[model samples]
Target: PTLRTSLPSSSPSLSPTSIPSSSPIYISRSNPTIRKPTLAPVQILYDVTSPKDDIKIYFGKDDNDGREGPPKPHEVATNVLDNSGKKYLNYNDLGSGFTVEVLDKCVIKGARFYPANDREGRDPSSYKIEGGRRRKNGRWRWSTIKSGTIRLPAARIKVTEPKLDPRFPHAEILFENQREFQMYRVTFPTLKDSDSEHSMQIAEVELLGYFTGGGVSLEGVRTTPISSSSLIAESSNPVSQKKRFKSTGTDRAENLQHSFEEKGPNYLLDLTTQYDMVGILKMNGVFKPDHPRYKKLTDKTGAGFISRVKNDALVIKPAIGKTVIRGARFYTSDSEEKYDPSSFVIDGGVEEANGEITWRRIRAGVLNMPSARVDRKTQNIDPELHPHDGVWFNNDEVYDMYRMTFPETKDNSVNYEMRISEIELVGYRSTRKLEESNFNIYDLITTIYFWRYEGSLTVPPCSENVQWRIFDRPIRISPRQQATLEWLIRAYRDPDTCQRATVGRPRRDGTGNVDVVRPTQAIKYDHLQVHCTSANY
Candidate 1:
């Protein structure tokens, strides 16, 4: 079924024709190319969920470099088969037998498989564990790395390879020799002489490898390798302690600089650092408050601030040229969860030679802030509660200079204020190299887990071009910092009006009320892909 988003009559209309022709589009989410260096043994585990009695697990390079399409059977490198000849426990049951381990010398030293069932007519003798290396010309050279017959209930096959050269004290040295690839394929093979049909099902596929401190570029080229000795030294200590920075009404420069030096420029700290807060606009009005349609901004139910990135814009240029952003990671501010933004829109485009900024709609989605279970007795995030951290947006088109508008929120009764600590953007980069352009967001977080999907911007000119990568973890802020966020929001003034901006609807009572959350919308599409760091960060 085709997926569609239903917007309110007052909301902007979305047309499929609005999608830009030159947009960057990724055929599929590829596994993380970078691998952290490790000295310990590495293991890749497959939790099969298939009901089929026979299955084969293939590991190595795919035909299209494991990017464009599914893996083909002929492109197998290292493979293991589960042919017990009889149904065992559930596919994901532990000890049902499917595991692989690589020793420090970068060799496939061991593998375990479920033993074949011994029945009157069953043949439980034939099984093979094969390993191969890929040639530079994109061809796989096959050889049986290890081979043995199955045991009674379970079989553990171990192989001993030649010792490594002591001169080069790194596991990557072995990888360089074999030219190993990083791709996995699981298929249900047909029975030898049976007419039974088989289906493919999988519950989980896990690859456990040591942190090599080395990384692979987007093009599958290996970067400079780090030694095991250095990796050991680095892993013993934490990278850096999280520092708390506050933004008071008067102390902006010092705090800003400290944050940049500590967290780097790409880490989302506050709106003031990255964007220029243009002004506040009423939700119902399309034009700015200064426009003739809405001559002056009024206290309304859906009023939000508009902000644009700084002069030196942050651009997202994927190697493919265009991409669809589906979602994002929104960190909560110090204020109560009620003040968090419930809905927003992200726009991206290039800046013209003139001072003007050209805009194209990128993504629209609701911000689902996790509940802050603040104990009345002691004001701190309750560790016991789930989702007390960050919310994921797995939903885009590509844009460099992103313009985000927070129009609606979770609660409308209170004055709306967005208090986000950080907004991490995760995805692939083009060959032009973002580092050359001073892109610091990459490698900000050691291990990143995210969900990717297709969605539209939540606001006007709702373009469906965004590729959302919402971080699974949330950034924690202190109570003092939360209070600081509230202070900053109220302190902000409209540059055009030279008047205080209205954050929420005005009530008759004298008491203060703040709410800027947009209600959750129905999900139109269901396709979601998950990506995580390959190494155990």
Candidate 2:
């Protein structure tokens, strides 16, 4: 029986010119080096495919580093080329395999494949050809282009009386629109004869198309290499919290300086004095059993005192760059009864050139303790919930801290309450050298000794992974702001219940000003260091 058709039969014996150099070009979608239509024949060696086959082989390179030349079809399978023995890349147990990015946009007319000589149950019978366009960021976004099956005969020499053995070496798979595209990906969804266990192997693959920019003669077609290192880095740390800051400019520094001078240095308070008061009490009334972790509390105060209240341990996530910060919460010590939530102004600015930094007030608000602990608290804290969250400074040279004051309820009250409010701090440096510098917040701003140490999270599950930062300077807030904070703390209700919790307990004396903070612990063997900074002028 003789088979005849309008389409010409493809054979390995025919000259490469027999196939039109323009319509169907022999291209290794895997390799970007060879762009011509004609390809030198390569052989495939027989071997079992492994699950760990590097998909990068399809890109025409031998390894991830591209140190070695492209693999010969017979030497080993770097990608899914099906030409020779021991050189075929395999699909995993699931028949899905690899994809390759093309160098330029082309109008793909059809495709051809040269199966390996030892093809048995391992040939791909049906599969999909996908195409993609390159985005501005140099990534190819892919979509399915065509779907078809292997219609050409297997690689076998035919037997005819006059030595008419038609070489069944190439399978011609046609495409729909000759659409232009920059990327192509192939996937073998199924195998021949309902066999799922065998992996697909192809010795040589060819795509028939012309460049879309002009024509076949167009020179200097641009190509972008898919960076392997960037892909690896992204996969390793997807959501890194470390932030860095950059300097802005120095023009606004003078106006800010004038504003600070008018306010005066008395506006700032040193919170270390409050800690000294706790030292005098010998931590008698500080430890409360009703705290989140009652067993962790100790009699000591200042540094090492662990209490049941989760807030005692110094835990913070630093936002160094343009990080957005949401809201804030307040906590108090057990001995502090006159303390109330405080209101203050928040200023944000960028560091500028020549030691001149400019700042402007961004937010004016108050911070309050939560009325409902269980209903408001979440197991995992997301630091990005606020709007002002990200890195603000280019480096760690000059940093900003929020200062708050809790004034006692009385006329002309000299006795006041103070503590550092927890911030959604991120990008904190674990190790750094410190030196005193003439960096001033304002003429009104006072420079104070700041300490950095490790503490536990002051909440339930009391995790001891907090790095605490305490600044010596505290900003001033008016009495009216303090009163507003008191009302908010006492009146604020649990969103879930729509009602405020009872405040008549022993520690909470219905004044709406209870100690929400973790009791100060004594500094044991941990080494402590103080650092200071001021304007360079």
Candidate 3:
């Protein structure tokens, strides 16, 4: 039953432009100045044709306990018709064909194997093998998968258009919050492609915050459970993991909270990056004690992050602000009758869904999409009701959102903890298809959770540490940008600063109008970056 796709009405809007109070103000509604992003002294990426086909090895589920045995002798094995489907297995299977889609929960998403048919790319001396048994065709060939490499270490940043004091709101500080402030760390110039100077192994580091406006270079790639109202966070250097303890107390303590029904197979963000909103900047990220829960943080309150409260009063609730919930809806609130923990209200309306996302296109030769003309009565709605379309931001659109105003410094003294304005990027990609149609024939083909991390902000108490950058080519957006990202994630989930404005029914309102709430920031994590280094629970 995995077949869903219902939203594509048309979306993409930002056009507002208004800074002229004689311009040059920098970013100060009162003490505003942060735009520092120049750090890349850490890196890792591998595609040596197949490193256990890129780590995430699977097969035999119910979440596995089959006890990890078969599958890798080079892990190119396959078998069609599994997952309650039917049957097919050619050498247990290993590449050439397979594809099926449906996740954001409609479930079903497979792609077993795909990478063998001599698409032509071999010559390590033709594998050096040729002197077989009975002749050269009797049996015993060897050499199907063996080429592992993913070294990383990098740093190259260049930004110079500032000599400010038009009031002073200039920025560039990536994770340096007074261990004696440390003169602002910005050293990076090491990766000629790195063969191994340890190849820059800092795994999941953090600290990135920024702001630079207009002329349209607003590059952004953030959204996937990384928030402090979506900007300014630092700290990515600390983890011990107890030592890889495999205990598993129920889906790894429920996959360590952040499940809005599977948002990005583990952090991803890619806001069509070309670079924009230039104002505040800072960055730093790494997490490798040997990851999996490496620097762990069951979130025992370091103020670093992960808060949603109200399950019988853990209190703190006012969710929704991953860019107004990704649709860039218009959410405005810093004060309006109620909902105000301290700022957020950009209301521009969004929440359109008919969903569909499944990939393996590498240049679109086939991953499939076609079908969707929708209207099976539009899938008939009420699957617990989502219904969103809201646009309410008038006052000339909240004065056109203070006319994009984000640069203002001078005695207004901007130090929201030292200046971290924005940066967030979370990503994932894993899909396989060895061969089959209509559904069924080898499984685990869709681990394609999308998110393109790193947007910069780390420096200044390193607020929630977010200097995440993951890009080696991964982009796919239109369906009206996924129904304007389901109407900007339902207008950036405002839940009212924490009285309860998040969880289900477009935030419920049987006609009560008490929905849409967000505001509860304080999970700063000091220097954040510990990519699931452990999860035994």
Candidate 4:
């Protein structure tokens, strides 16, 4: 390599180039006119054309030109096209041409000298010293020579694996690069502050240097592709700790500790004293019909109907084994006034009490009968306070409740419970054998007994469990009251368009979905108590 200076000149015969003698070096470039391709290990490409402005090349090993000055354009160009030099390419081999500038050089020819100018004979600024006069010895004359430097930019090296994919070479210029039609410059001041440093002595800085798809080896070589296995290798020490579960000791904790409930309350089920049965009789005002499930809720008539009554009624018979409470009877008692228990009327439908209510073991012989009463008030049998409001149901304004219906007693609006007799459906008052097919007075008497055991008041939070007292007697219901209940079940028409309310399932109402009843809750235990306060005369 040689350090070259220049003599400046201007002539029309030579190509006019704006490249400065102090131009950046492009160590790599290729003669596109030839097919002798250059590789990264041989050359580096650079931009030297100064048509627009100065091209900034940074300082680094890639641009390290050991010559006393920056690499010249000819050297840069020759290096790219040359096959005799080292395989390591310079800027010219990379295909980016270098810029060449013409410089002025002094020539000492015997006493008389000629001006060193371009072929056009024009003197560049360098050829004319700032204040030199024309009287100098001819031997000291200077002339301009075509002088320029080549720039070699930093480049990436890679183990080109084009065989992997000929279309996408393993190592080549990356697509969408800043090097593509973009200006890359290198500027570094290796000495003192800007103005104090010698232009040729500063160490260069790096602007761009890369090797495609390679890792930097400890030996200062980037030659490996990143892979998943090596990336997931963890350090020797544990990276994280596992979490443990927490245990809470409270109500449930205590309960869990208790293995079992050995023994406690033993109920001597006195089926005869079942208060729910009495309450049902009083509510329905009559007997309940027969049912198949016996104790379970089912489609059986005796298991479903309910009742309640007003001051003008009395229970005649609650069905018993289909025998109308089997000789069921009611007597009136007016402790404050003169009253005959037998004379107290029972709507003339109830048969005289033959036997009492009883409970028999599942397999014990024949079942025996025991007396039935409302808190031992069998003698107090009389009219109820709230009679049916003309419908088959009695409205309990205070409780906001209604005993939907009853069956056996040929009654309506009476008891909420079914007599044990209702359950067995063994005995029932003949009542002229009145049935659903007939609206005869018998039909008006006893109603089915059971209740859904739910809440009342078709309103919110509908809290329940109020004791319903329906009479085992059946009474005629006015047609108007039945109509009221019917309205509640079906949809009402919009009076304007006369659009009937779409009943059935909710939503179809043209409004939204809604449930007429509440869902049931699981029950583990229940409690009850009956207090008979002596009535004031």
RMSD of each: 25.2, 34.9, 28.6, 51.6
Identify the leading candidate in terms of lDDT.
2
Q: Model 2 RMSD to the real structure?
A: 34.9
Ranking by lDDT: 2, 1, 4, 3
Measured on C-alpha atoms, candidate 3 has an lDDT of: 0.19
Model 4 — TM-score against the truth? 0.12
Candidate 3 stretches with Cα past 4 Å from truth are 1-477, 481-537
Tens-place lDDT per residue, model 3, 1-537, is 111122211222211111111101122223334222221111111111111111222222121212223433322221111111111111211111112110010101111111111111110111110111222667433321111221221221111211111111111111111111101111122222222121111111112211111111111211122322222112111121112212356553233222222343232222111111211111111111212121111111111111121111011111111221121111111122121111111212111232211111000000111111112122211101211111111011100011111122111233321111111211221112265667753232232332333333432333443555433334434333443454454445555574443242343422222222334344444535333212412
| Weakest lDDT window of 10 consecutive positions for candidate 3 | 360-369
Which window of ten consecutive residues has the lowest lDDT sum in model 2?
Answer: 229-238
For all candidates, the clash counts are: 50, 79, 150, 150
Predicted candidate 1 versus true structure: per-residue lDDT over 85-140, tens digit per residue:
22222222111223232211121223223222222112122233333456899976
Order of models, best TM-score first: 1, 2, 3, 4
Model 4 RMSD vs true structure: 51.6
Candidate 2 residue lDDT tens string, 1-537? 011112223443222112211111111212312223332221111111122222343322222222333334543443233222233535341244455544334445566555554544556677677777778999878777777777435653221212111133567665445345555676666556424333455554555543332111111221111111111101001122111112225533333233223322222111111101121101122322223222111111111122222112221112222222222223223323333233332333343444332332222222333222211122212222211111111112222322122222211145343332222221222223386988875634434555567666665555666777776665444333454565565566778998875342224343335443566765656534445445312
Model 4 agreement with the true structure over 1-537: per-residue lDDT tens digits? 101122223222111111111111111112112121111111111211212222222222222322223344432232211212211112211112222110111111101001111111111111111111133564222222211221222221122211111111111111112111112221111212112221221111111111110111112111121111111111111111001101234443233122111111111100111111222223222434323322221111112222123222222122111111111112111121111111111111212244222111000000111222222222211112111100000111111001111222212223422222122111111223444764565434344442223334334544555453444433434333443454455555667897765443463433223345445545424523233233311
Ranking 1 against 4 by lDDT, winner: 1
C-alpha lDDT of all candidate models, in order: 0.30, 0.34, 0.19, 0.21
TM-scores for all candidates: the values are 0.26, 0.25, 0.16, 0.12
